[model samples]
Target: MTPSQIAAFCLQLPGAREDLKWGSNRVFSVAGNKMFAILDFLDEGRGGLAFKVDSDLFLGYVDRPGISPAPYLARAHWIALQRPYPMGAEELRAALTRSHQLVVARLPKRLRLGLLLDPA
Candidate 1:
């Protein structure tokens, strides 16, 4: 799918929000106050998109056309996936769910509880 299409897909998750951070070039989406995906191609070759992915499963995506280890965050458990992949929409949705889950897993217990209990 296209970049905008991918970005829109990422934002479809419940309570997802986007912002132009990292110099206002990339668009990042967060869930439960945790970032799950970021748009790195909005500018050009200077930036790359990153998603919260498990290190073990990360290797599977590394060699994909536009996929790679996210810059500094890669070592901290992040992967950059280039848009327009041959991957199907179902696979993309699963990846997004995985990314969102990874971030949720890292949140503090109290914060996690709050997110679960708070309904607005």
Candidate 2:
């Protein structure tokens, strides 16, 4: 997906918010400050995208063309897409949704319940 489409998708997730960080990078987070995805506008050519991935699948994802371990965050099982074309748009959306869920699952019980009850 294009950057704007990706941004819109991320923001539609329950309690998800976006912030511009490190100048041109757009950071998407849930439950106040736990980031689930990031879009780097400064990358040459098409922007770069990164998101959390299931730990067991991290290595497998990074082995794919155009996918790499996210800088400084890979140890936590995050993967960066140098270009969004490595996966189809629908697959990218599914991965983004999974990333959001994974981050939400790690949040405190009360916060998760609040998100479910009132996503505004």
Superposition-based RMSD of candidate 1 using all C-alpha atoms, in angstroms: 3.8
lDDT per residue for candidate 2 within 8-34, as digits (tens), equals: 999998899999888888999988899
Clashes of 1: 1
Which regions of candidate 2 deviate over 4 angstroms? 41-45, 117-120
In the range 8-100, model 1's lDDT, one tens digit per residue, is 877776556787665654455543346777776444644345677887877777867667777767776777665455467788778877887
For candidate 2, the lDDT comes to 0.87
lDDT of each: 0.66, 0.87
Task: List the lowest-lDDT window of 10 residues for candidate 1.
Answer: 24-33
Candidate 2: C-alpha RMSD to true structure equals 2.7
